[model samples]
Target chain A: MDKVTEEELIGRSIKGDRRAQKSIYDALSPKMFSLCLRYTGDRAVAEDILQDGFITLFGRLDSYAGKGSFEGWARKIFVNTALMYLRKTDALKLSGDIEDARSLDNGEPPPGQQIGYKELLKMITSLEPSSRTVFNMHVIEGYSHKEIADSLGITEATSRSKLQRARLKLQDMIRKRN
Target chain B: MEDFENRFDLEVRSLMENAEEDVPSRIWDGVSSALDRKKAPVPAAVWWKRAAFAVAAAAAAAAAVFLVPRSTPDNTPTPGAPMVRTEVPVTAAPALLSEAVPSRPIIVAAAPAPAPAVVAAETAPQEMPSPETTETTVTKKDTKDQGQTAKVPLSFNKALFNKESRPKDIGRISISAGGNLQSNGSPAKMLTGFRYARAKAPAKAGITEVSESTYGMTLSAGIGVRYNFNPKWSIGTGVTYSLLSRSFTATYYDTSSPDLSVTGKTDNFQHYIGIPLNVYYNVISRNAIKFYVWGGGSVEKGVANKFILHDSSRDIRLTERIPGVQWSAGGGLGVEFAVAPNFGIYLDPGWRYYFNCAQPNSIRTQQPFTMNFEIGIRAGF
Candidate 1:
C-alpha cells in the first residue's frame, strides 16, 4: 500500500473509506478515550461515549471544511458526546441553569498547595451530582453561563447562581480534606 | 464578572491541564476492540466523479421515466423541499452540467443553494416529498466531495491505467487518527522498558511495586502529498499531532527500606505538528498483498526527553527537560482491496524508532529505548 500522509488519511476517512476509518480510529483512540473518561468518570461509560462519538465523527466528517484545527473539531465531538451521555444518564439537573454558589465566609488553612490536581478532581467528583455537574461544565469545561443555559435549557442567571453554589460546595469539600 | 472569572479560570485551567485521571484498565481493552473492529460502511462513498457520472445518468433516467406534467396544486405537495444538486465544473465537458445537474431546484433556479453542499445531508429533513430525493443527495455528496476526502492510494500502476497522460497530482492527503495499546503482554519489556530501568522512581515505593500504566491515546490530524518518482517509488511529507500521556506506578525504595506503593506517572503529551519528509521503497505487489519501507525525520514541539519527579507526597512536580531533534525511520506491510479506480483501502502495519531522545551520559540510555507503532489506511487520488 502507498505510505499515506495525514491529510490523505483524514481525507480518506472523510471520504468513507472503511480502512481510512479504522486508520483514524487507531490514530485518535487514546486521547479521545481519555477525554470521554474524564467527562464520564467511568471507563465503560467512557467507551460507550467514545464509540458513539466516532460514529458521529464518521457520519458528519463531511462537514469538516479544513477550517479550524481538526483536533479542535474532534475534541468538540468527544466532549459533546460525553455531555450527551451524561444528559441521558442524569436528566441533566445542571440543565436547570446554575453557575455559582453564594459565598460563605469560610476561613482558610495553611496553604502549600496541599492538594494535587488529581486529588482535587476526586474531591470535585464527590460533590452532589447537581453541584459537580455545574462546577464541571462551567469551572472545568469553560462553558459560559449563557452557553450552559442553552445546553441545559435553563436561564443564564440560573446558570450563574448555580455555579456560585457549586464553588461554595467545592470550597467546603477542600476544607474538609485539610 | 470577567475579573473574578478570569482569575478562577486561570486556577482551574492549570489544574485541568495537568489533571490525570486514574482510569480503569478495561477502558484500554474497550477502545482497542472498538478500533480493531472492521470499519463501518458509511453508505459506501465510492469514487465520486465516477459515481456521480453514473448516478447523474441514472437520475436523468429516473426523472424522464417518472416525469409527471404540471398537475394540480394538490397533486404537488405545497412548500415541498427543493431538490438541490450543484454543478461540477469540467472544462472538457462544458455542456455536461445541464445533463449532470439541473440548474437548481426545479422551481427555485434563481434561489439560494438549498443548503451548504456539506451540511445539506444530515440536517436535511427526512419527510421530504420523495425517497428518490435521498438518493440524489447521496449521489451528490459522493461526487462533489473529491477535494474533502483525499485518500493516498498506494498503487501507482493503478494510476498508470488512467485515461490521461499527465503525472499523478500530489494533492492527495492521508491522516491517521486513533488507537493505541498499553501493552502487548510484554511483561518483561513493560517492566524494564528503556525509559528508566535503574533510576530511583517516585519518592515512595511499596513491597509489590504496582504498575501505573504505559498508556497513550492521541487525537491527530494532518495532511500530506506524494510525488510519484516512478511507478514504484515516491516521496511524501505531512504534519501530524500525537497527544500521548503514559504512566507507570513504581514503589519507592529510599535506600532499599520498605515504603508503600504509590502511582507515579510521566505524561508526554506532545503536539508533533511537524513535517515528515520520507522516501518509500515499495515491495513489488502480486495482487492484494504488498509492503514498503519508509524513513524520515520529525520537526516537532512538546515532544520531549524528560524525567519528571513526583514528590513523595505527589504534591509537586519537577520537570527535567532534555531536548533534541528526533530522527525517525520505519517500514510497513499491508494489503489493498480495490473498491474503486480512483479509490481503494489498504492496511499497513508500521513500526518506527526514534533516536536522539536517548539520555546523554546516562548508563541506562541504550537499555531504555522508545519507539512508536501504527497501522493506518488511506484512500484517494
Candidate 2:
C-alpha cells in the first residue's frame, strides 16, 4: 500500500474500524507469521505470538508517529512479541558451551546440491532454542552482538559464541542432507 | 573461516528475511473477538444522552406532582382551630340543640322573615379546642316557627378535629451497599512521579517494555440518615467506604552477571472513607411505593493506598499514604416500596463524576465518570 492509504488504514484501525483492521491484518499476518515461526520454531507458538503482536500493535497504534516505515515498525512489534514469549518460557537461557560440531561440518555442499528454502528452514528450526534465537537475531534480523546481548539480556561474548555454534550446527545439518 | 561464516549468513538472510506463510483463519476470529471485547463500553456520547433522558424524566415527574390538585376529604377537617359552619334541618334542630347545649338554656332570637336554616360552630384559642369550650349558633326555618334563631354551645371531641395537613415529622436511618460499573476503555493514568520512575528505570537498566494498566471492579457500602421536611422533599447525609483497584505489568532487566529480564505484575488498591450529602424530591407517592429523584456530592479521604508486586522470583508490597480529599457529584432516581408503614426498601441508580484530587494514579483518576446502582432498606421513626 502507498503511504497515504496506509496512514488512512492505520487511522481507521486506531479508531476501531474492524474492516480496516482486517485489511491491515490480511496484509501483514503472513509475513509476521513467518517471522514468528522463525523465532519460535513451533507453528502453534508462532500463531500465539502473531495474535499477541497484532493485539499490541493495535493497542499502541497511537504511538506510531509515522516516523519510519510502517512495515519496519510492525516488524519490530512482532520481533518483540516473539522475544517476550521466549523470555517468558525461559527458552533463551544459554547453557555452557555445546560440543563443537566443527568436525561434522564437511568443507562445503557437493556441486549441484542446492538447499531449498524449506530444507534450510527445517535445519534452522532443528537447532536448540537458545542457538536458534541468537542466530535469528544476529544473522537474519541483522542485529549486532551488543544489540543482541542487550535484547536477550546476555553478554556480547555469549551472543557471539551462540551465533557461531548455531552456524556450525546448520552447516553440519546441510552437509548431512547433501 | 570468518569469510565462510559471513557468506552463509548472507545466504540465510536472503532466504528468510522476506519469508511469508499462510496464516490460519481462526487467528483472525480471535483477533476480531478481542477487539469487540475492548470496544464493549458505552461511548461517552451515549452516556451523556442517557443522563439527559434521566434528568428529563425526573423533571416531568416533578411537574406532574406540582400541577395536579390535591383534594381534602370532608370528614377530615383541615388542621388547626377554625370556625366551622354547617346547615341543620328543622327536623334535626331539636336533637342537635339538646345534645350541644349544656346545662345553660338555649337563647332563641325570633326574626320576621323566613330564611334558610344555618348552624355555625366556633372553636376558641387557635390551638385544639376542648369539648366544653366550643360554641355553636343555630337558625331554624320552620313554617310553624318562621325565622327562629338560637345560640347553642357545642362540644367537639378533640380527637375528631385534630387532623394535620402536612406529613408528620419523619427521620429515617438506612444501610446501603452497591457496586459501580466503570468503563474499561480508559487505562489508569499513572502518577507522574511513578511513570517517571518506570520510564527512567527502563533507560538506566536497559528495560524496554511496560504494559498498559487495567482497572478492576469498584465496591462501596455505607449507612445514612435522612430527614423528611415535608411529603415532597427530604435531605440525607451518609458515611461510606469505597475500594478501588487496578493492575499493570512491567518488564525489568537486571544488568548483573547473569543478565536476565523479569516480568513483574503490580496491583494497586486504594481505600476511601467518605461523607455524602444529598437532597431528594418525591415525584410520586402511592399506597406502598414512592418515587424520588436525588442529587448529591461527597468528599472522600484515602485511608489506605497499597501496591503489591509479583515476579517469578518473589513478591514485594508497599504502602503509602495519600493526602487530599476526593470530591464527587452525582444524581439519580429512586423507587421505594414500603413493606410496612415505617419500613421500606429502595433502589437507586445514578451517575457520578469524580474530580481530580491531586492524589496518586488510580482508576477514579483515569475514568472519573461512572454509573452506580444502590439498594437498601430504610426505617422511619
Candidate 3:
C-alpha cells in the first residue's frame, strides 16, 4: 500500500475515514508511546495514555490549524494526555516544598563508573512523581521554571526546588550504582 | 555534584530523543471498536429562531390585548331584553322633525313584575296604530287610578333604537388553572434493538430484540392568563410541568447461540417544562355557555429522565438518553360555562405533534404526537 501524506491523512481522518485513522495511529503511536512511558514510568500505563491520546487526536483533527508541523501538534497532544492521566490517577500531587526534603550532595560520581542513557532513564523513573514531572518538563522538554509552575499549578519556587531535588537524587542514585 | 547532575541530564535527554517502541495491536482493537459504537452528530438546534418565535407570539398577544378591542364593537344584547320606555308630549312634534325621532310619544307599557319591559320599538307602524287611538293610549281613568302619567305609541326608526340598546363593553381578562391528560396519538416502538450480554458467553456476544412500547397516561398542571380582546377572540400563554412516562417488554434471543432467550420489562419517566403560546376564538359566546377553538405551539425542555430494567433476578438502572429541547404544535376545541361574573369552568380536547422525537438514542423509534384533554376553572376580571 502507498503511504499517504500527513496532511491528506489528517483531512481523511477528519472526514472519519477508518483506514486513514489507522494509518495516522500507526505512524505516531510508537514515538508517542515512548514519550508516555517517559512520563508514566510504566508500560501498561504508557499504552493506555497512548490509546487515549490517539483517540483524542482523531476526534479533534479539525482543530489542527495547519500553521505548524502536524507531528509537532500531535506531540503537544501526547504531552497533555500524559499530564491528564497523571491528574486523573491522583499521581500529580504537589506536596512538601522541595526544600523541605533533606538535600543531597550534587558531587560528581566516583570517576571510574560510567552511566549510559538507559541507566539515566531508570534513575529518573525512580524519583517522586511531582519531581519527575518537573525535571522532565524543565530539563528534557526545555520548559522554563515559570512555565512548568503554571502548567503544573504550582509556584515557580516549587518548580525550581523540585528540579534541584531531582538532580540531587539522581546524583545519589548514580553514585550508588557506580 | 554539578558535573554528575549535568552528565545525568545529558544522558537522559539523549535517551528520550531516541526512545521509541511499537504500539501493541490490542490498543488498535479497542479504539476501532469504540469508533464503531459512536453515532453521527445530532443536528444542532437553531435557538435564535425559537426565541424569535416566542417573542413574536408574546408581542402579538400583547398587541391583541391592547389594540383589537378598540375596533371591535361591544356585545349586543338580545332584542327581548327589558328596556325603559318614556312618552313624549304632543307639543314636542316640531322637535321630532328628523327621520330618526318619533313624531309621537313612546308608550311605556305596563310589563308585569319580574318581567323585563322591552319596548318593541322595531314593531311596524301599524303595530303602533294611531297615537290618538283610544285603545293604544292610556285612558284618563286608568292614568288617574295608577297615579302615573299617560303613555302613547310612538313612531321611531327601529334600527337606530336597536343600535342604541346594545350592551356596553364587558371586556375582561381570565386567569385559569388546569390539569392536562395526555397519551401518545400514535403508537411508539420501544426497546428497539436492545442488546444484553449473556454473562457466560464469550466476549462481544449478546442478545438483541425489538420490543413493544405502551405509554401510560401523563398528567400536567398549568396556570394561564388570557386577555379577551373581545368576548369572541382572545390570546393566551402559560407554563406547564409535564411528566411523560412509558413502558416496554421484549423477548431477547442470543444471536450467537440462537437458543438462549429472556423476557425483560423496562419503564421510563421524562420530566419537561413546557411553555405554550395559544390563540383562542370563541365560537359560541352566550350568557352562560361558551365554546372556543384554540391552536398554538409550545417549546419544551426535558430536564431529567429515569429508566429501569426489571427482571426476575434484579432491577438494573439503564442510562436514559433524552433530547434536550423539543418543539410541538397543536390545537383543540374547548367548552366553558360562566358560573359567575368573575368565574368560569372549562374542558378542552386537543391534539399535538412533536416536531422531532425526544430521545437521542439510536436504538428506539419514536411516535411524535399525543391526544390531550384538559379541565379547569377560569377566573375573569
Query: Quick one: best lDDT, which candidate?
Result: 2
Docking class of 3: incorrect
With candidate 1 superimposed using the best TM-score fit, by how many Å does residue B280's alpha carbon deviate from the native? 61
Task: Give the TM-score of chain A in candidate 3.
Answer: 0.83
Per-prediction DockQ comes to 0.05, 0.22, 0.13
lDDT for each residue of candidate 3 in B188-247, tens digit (9 for 90 to 100): 321122222111111111212123345556668999988777656788888898877666
Q: Ranking under lDDT, best-scoring first?
A: 2, 3, 1
Judge candidate 2 at residue B278 and give its lDDT.
Answer: 94
List ranges where model 2 is wrong by over 4 Å: A93-113, B42-216, B219-243, B248-277, B280-381
lDDT of 2 by residue, A1-178 (tens): 6888899999998888999999899989988999999888899999988987787677667667798788877887777778877877888777877444452324563211367777888888888888999898889877788877767667788888888888877876776677
Q: What is the C-alpha lDDT profile of model 3 across A71-104, one tens digit per residue?
A: 7667766776677667657677877755744545
Task: Look at candidate 3 and give me any clashing residue pairs.
Answer: A106-B1, A107-B1, A108-B1
- Which residue runs of candidate 1 sit more than 4 Å off their true CA positions? A1-6, A16-30, A94-100, A104-114, B1-5, B17-381
Instruction: Give TM-scores for every candidate, taking all chains together and pairing residue i with residue i.
Output: 0.34, 0.52, 0.45
Q: How close to the true structure is residue B256 of candidate 2, measured as C-alpha lDDT?
A: 62
Which wins on lDDT, candidate 2 or candidate 3?
A: 2
Please write out the lDDT profile of model 2 over residues B1-381, one tens digit for every residue. 666677778888888888889999999997786667553434667666655665566456644543333342122233454534332322232334445435333333221112111223222212233332433334433343343333432212221111321244344444444433433322233121121111111122222334446666566788888878777788998888888776665444344622233455667788999999999988766434567899999999999887665654466465778788999999888877545445566777688888977766565665567666566777667
